[model samples]
Target: MFSFSRSPYMTALFSFGVFLLFIFLQNTVIYTSLQTVFSTGGLCACKKCVMDLNDDDWFFMRFNPTVPALLNRRNSAMRSDVFTWWKGLQSDPKKANFSDVVDVLFSLFPDEEHHVVTDPNRCRTCAVVGNSGNILGSHYGQLIDSHNFVIRINKGPTKGYETDVGSKTTHRIMYPESAVDLDNSTHLVLLPFKIKDMLWLISVFTTKHVTSTYTRVRPSINAVREKVMIIHPAFIKYVYESWLRKHGSYPSTGFITLIFALHICDQVSVFGFGAKRDGNWHHYFDNSLAHFSRGLHRGDYESRTIHELLLMDKIALHKGV
Candidate 1:
């Protein structure tokens, strides 16, 4: 047997050295653990002990719910071209990048279509509904869930709205800016606004971190097999330019989301899109009524656009639709 004896001071020094090595080796774990740290550590780290947690910033961006990314890129050229708006600076995309965006009507979408490689088998019928809180207690929840796949956006909670809407939600769409944790097989609908979000999505999905700090209240990103659907920055710019020419501002978030839905769902029906009561847009959040409160009206412009969609057979009118 080997004899092992040491002074208390020497043992203490050895323990300290081992602890330091452990911290350095487990940096990723430390980084993720820091989310609940302010709430996790029970006490703040010393100024000298604090290390830069660059990953936290990136992880939080994953849950951003406002203005999320329903589209990815053909390549990085979309941004590069837009950034260098100079006439002569325009550069043609390589053949590979050319297919960055392709217009596909929702009616023709394939079940196993993956533009890059191969896509998974997904449901055929899909629906994306926007809740203005205008339909709270309207009992549309069940009706909303009647489709093969139901998609819900921000402020969509089925528990309370089940009576009116139906509780069948196939996918809950959102972004890091507007993400809310819910109990369902909700896909974190990433709608990237800035270049950073796109970069983060590219990195996260590709790196494939099994235990990413991206979320804890939720599990590591599932249903990501859908991959990033490339949306052309040009398309966004084109839509906005057209809108400015006609109206003045770009489509509201709900309408923008609706346009995206129109391109993805086969049969579409809209309920509670317009305000139940006029003028008071901020009704649900502001109104004093508890059970019968209808939420805010998005705006007249979006309603007009939605109406145009209705006329074109793109969407059905209100009432259990």
Candidate 2:
């Protein structure tokens, strides 16, 4: 004990530090796993997402609002760098002029037939629903159902939460990647990835078996009985590519879906739009009733941004969020 005078207290402190390090490592690993990368369709399994190309557009598409502004001047509103970069995924991977119309088409997309919900009589009211924890125990189901059309985004399993979100779902928007299998009463609106996904849907309903392409998805033969309809992304891309992207950070996948609802529907009542791990967006669950906003974390900044938007009537929120 005389030699170097090492204290037992120091050793105990070192052990505590090691315990904290263990907790930090465990939490870091779990948090990383829970965060699923958002893509147009469920999760992407594509090599290069198109082959021979590697770029992370979805990440850029998330935040950093200025990117759109930089693109606004171009015909397609995409900088040359972006254009050259995502060229492979564009409609005509060969021609630049063919794509010039891409942006303008998005701008004039409303004129396209079947794009706008043109019952001018029904244009005044709209509701934008999210997975926000605020919807639970709100009894907003009847109110939500009362709308001219109900808009749901990335939402699945409409069983117990029907009261808060609404039992009657008119138009549910989703990319095939995240499309939840719904009953015949609900429509599986196909949000296409590129021409391929859209064509795949049509082919399924009309002629071919897309099941050959995907196993996780139910065959079109089965889909016919289920009443599925593929929505052209042009309509959505047009609106978002025009105003929303320029104004805010990348519009939420759900929020963009809601704008389409507003463009076509009237008198909307939002519910359960921004749910979290706790399932509180429409806490009407049977197992446990939770009340927490769906954030990257318990109280992430983006979650707050979305809430402010909801409060401003840009969208709607539940009490908890």
Candidate 3:
């Protein structure tokens, strides 16, 4: 063994090298932590992150325990109070064997209690794509497709507008009047405001007798029968009463879809909701100017509610350029 005398300079150099190594290690830890937070939507672990209903006092105040998000065979029957309220949303308030329609509906599809199950260790990110013309040229297709779930509302087409609207659709929320054919992979989420809407859904796969509702609807839609989902009337009532505060006739399909995302998704990003830069409302796939005020929905109130949700940091809104 060679005996080496440790000089002061050598000792100092070793100390400095150790300090630099420590600093490098510290910086590495910090960088990794930041990356984790940013990638998981500012959460330490997305699976552990639950939607804090009470995080915002304003939202918590209106949290209704009675309203469930989805409907299955177990909770298909509506209470008398809920039935009275839900049926009033549409013009066809007359009782038309809701139980029978729901029975037939469930028979034709999966009667699972929930469409989506939240996992403690999984982050389900969703993109709720509206058909507003604002996203016409925004080129959000890639970003929309990046989400775990991409939900398209009504008859928003993605064929020619793939650059902006995206081609992937996990869920399509539509009523009878706004019905569109879906590929086998997509979930046909029906927002049934009336018993007839549910009947139309059943007929679409079976009899195809229900040709139209308020407007011409496809007698038979090309969708996966197994993947069909029906929005609970109680949920619609909850959204109308709790979220919208009974604004307009009921919650619009876009708003309902947004609230639906809030229930199942870990992170929700909305796109193409509001009007364009010109303040004119129109579909991204169409040149027709839409009059939100003329519709049954109270467009102004819904817009304000969406803004409030944005301010509360409940959901992220990607208003297109």
Candidate 4:
């Protein structure tokens, strides 16, 4: 019979082999877990699409300790600092009974605390379609529609422009000033700049008494009552403070919509943002010249911030020609 006792060399070789096998098994488990966590049918299912929690800026923008994204009954009270900053956005900052307003609003709409729940086993892909003129001839309709969620900003018509701006609208982000009718399937996301804005939302579905804020707004909107969602006042202030760094008077609707996607989506792709090569700013739907600098927002700074986000690989921009 051969001797059973192992030599020092043999023992060392056996231990090394075991160590290598252990490492291989460990790596396999890790890769499998990652696949399950980030699984999706879209481009953002890859490892790179995952937001880095370790990143300070991402952490600050994404995980707000004080502010929640959407307003519900549980988080109805507005923080003092957030209220002060938000109320200053409009001239008519008349104090209204916020709790009472929300109480009636929730009864009309869904009182759910959250809309999109982040899940490790799922990946949500979002397309933020802006109204920039660059998207005119891009023929990105098919590509834009491919996303899980397609968000269109203020009155971006898709009837004639369907080839460029896709017809599929999962969410519409608008304030009362930019309000548009929505189909049954689409979510009507209202970004309230004032307490009256909230009341306007309530009135639209009920009284139809509150028609105008600073200007005349639609007394009744064509939208599914249950599908309506209001952005939290604190969230608006949070974006202004954290993301914009107070660069502009407040974050633009486009910018706020982008940030909203970042919080709820696993992968975000932007379309129709920025000016054309000719350096003229206009909406894709018409020949009218639109100026980013003309509004209350600092469009230049917001553009630069968007570029910074692109540099950070946080979002993919489809610069349509």
Each model's number of backbone clashes?
A: 35, 20, 0, 0
**Displacement of the residue 110 alpha carbon in candidate 4, Å:** 0.9
Which consecutive 10 residues in model 1 have the weakest lDDT in total?
Answer: 43-52
TM per candidate: 0.51, 0.49, 0.82, 0.82
The global C-alpha lDDT for each of the candidates, from Candidate 1 onward, is 0.45, 0.46, 0.81, 0.81
| Candidate 4 lDDT trough over 10 residues, lowest sum | 53-62
- Stretches off by above 4 angstroms in model 3 are 1-44, 47-50, 93-95, 293-295
Clashes of 4: 0
Q: Per-residue CA lDDT of candidate 2, range 1-321, in tens?
A: 453338787778888999999998985564444343322222233211111111333323232212221011232344454443333333532232524434433342322333232222223444556665666677777777766556677544457777777777655666544545555555556664444454445555565564433325534533322345444333434434543433332344555565455344333345655554454444234334444333212323335545644544434455543
Model 4 CA lDDT for position 318: 95
- Poorly placed runs, candidate 1 (over 4 Å): 1-76, 79-125, 182-184, 199-232, 242-246, 283-298, 319-321
Kindly indicate the candidate among 1 and 3 with the higher lDDT: 3
- What is the per-residue lDDT of model 4 for residues 1-321, given as tens digits with 9 covering 90 to 100? 544255777778888999999998985675555445433432244455534433334443444433588888988877787777878888875578777888898889999965455545566788999999999999999999999999999899899988998899999999888999999999999999898888888888888898788899988889999898889888888888787778768889999998888777777899999999899998888779877875677888889878877877778999999
Candidate 4 colliding pairs: none
